[model samples]
Target: MIQRRLPIASASLLGLAAALSACASGNDLPSADTAASQVTTIGVNSYLWRASLEAVSFAPLLQADSAGGVIVTDWFANPENPAERVKLTVSILDQDLRADALRVAASRQVSQGGGWVDAPVQAATVQKLEDIILTKARELRRQAIAS
Candidate 1:
């Protein structure tokens, strides 16, 4: 009889420990409503995202994903340079509006034998675009803060 009571007491202690641990784990997790409230318009900086779109609006947009913070533009040819065209891809890599968080890649193509051929894109071109976008993003952020 004493042995049976001891086993029951040990089992009860084990169950209580398990229950306390479960409650602790639950406390560490956020509720669904809390997560929903934290959602934003974009994954990266909003000022940078909007400024990037405005800067690239001159070109035809092929894809834009706010969640992924990527913008791809279709090949654009200038009337002055009918033989050469450029395609641009912009990536917003961070939630902060920092220079390292923005990346610009340009693809250049030149007409060769009535077909488009890949050409080396100048590093300066990509850097200039990035600078322009960053400047615009800073300006937008400033305006928002002032207002």
Candidate 2:
């Protein structure tokens, strides 16, 4: 399954890059009315998708499906705290750039007795991640418009 998805993910990233470059070249800039939101050639808002990827980029990705608007990150243990690890899943639920269009879920684990054990993730952590993604998405939209 991952082998099949590699091509699709690569193609999607290439398409997004091409689209963004086109936008940067001032050939396909959206009008003022639609520029604030709804800049998407894929299944979800390109800005949000890109922002989510950037937010979790420090971790290894397990799956990324642009058509399905899902990004799953493999377990990541911060260098400062190897005993604790986290995995993230981000879902882009809409084609428009809106606060409700993004969802972030996290699973946490802590090392116990030389073994990993599930730990509860704080609600604020999830909310903060969503906020970061949304902010970056909005910033990307603004830059796209400015360019």
Candidate 3:
């Protein structure tokens, strides 16, 4: 009875391994016939890229590079708080719609008499901005899929 169980377990394990190996195999895309479909791709996920641009459109842009998947903004001063200003950087790390793929950094400065001084930024501010970007990305993706 023990010998019979051993064979069954071995067969099951072999089947699992085969399935995983098949999944790991890459698509045969380099063939001449498939060259047209293999256009160059942007470094980051498309939805996230568009959404990040839209979210920060209010701020003046310093640099935007789709191939590098980075967006840097010029310092923006709030009308209500003329003495404080903030600059934002958005980095997209992967070509997938995942929370870990997006990174948001903010730098805050306040006027100290005549010179601008760096100020400690609240963690919540960064997180909230990330959430907004993610939400917009999801919406954009959904719309794209529907169309």
Candidate 4:
């Protein structure tokens, strides 16, 4: 009777193991194609965040928060144009790499009488910056896929 019971228990254990293996298959995981575009490991899209940093690397960073998705740059004055200075604020609005997910704001100042005075930022200038950042982000994503 003991020998018979041992064989029955072994069969039961084998059946349970097979069922568990079937459940562990990884069908629910995201596909490689979609995974790159939807990456949010750092609260916002990683590609966009990196591209924004690269685009404004010329200026000193005043504040950078990954979780908040905001990057602020200190005043940067061109060497050729010492009389004018500009500051930049870049915000990542969403976790996707879409055109509408990014916002760029600029503050301009002109040296007047040895003091700085606020000046209007050109709309075209802001638009161009946004375009650059978006293009860089896309390129980064493509590189990620190629690798």
Better of 2 and 3 by TM-score: 2
The stretch of ten residues in a row with the least summed lDDT in candidate 1 is 30-39
Candidate 1 local lDDT, 126-146, one digit each (tens)? 999999999998887677556
Q: Which predicted model would earn the best TM-score?
A: 4
- Cα lDDT of model 2 by residue, 14-66, tens digit: 99999888889966766665455987777789999999999999999999999
**Regions of candidate 4 where Cα sits further than 4 Å from its true position:** 1-31
Candidate 1 global lDDT: 0.85
Error of 4 at 106 (Å): 0.3
In model 2, the Cα lDDT at residue 62 comes to 100
lDDT of 1 at 135: 96
lDDT of 3 by residue, 1-147 (tens): 999999999999999999878767877334453222112267678778888999889899999999888999999999999999999999988877888889999999999989999998999999998999999988876775566
- TM-score of model 2 (CA atoms): 0.76
lDDT (C-alpha) at residue 89 in model 1: 96
TM-score of 4: 0.78
Clashing pairs in 3: none
Candidate 3: misplaced stretches above 4 Å? 1-40
lDDT for each of the candidates? 0.85, 0.94, 0.85, 0.94
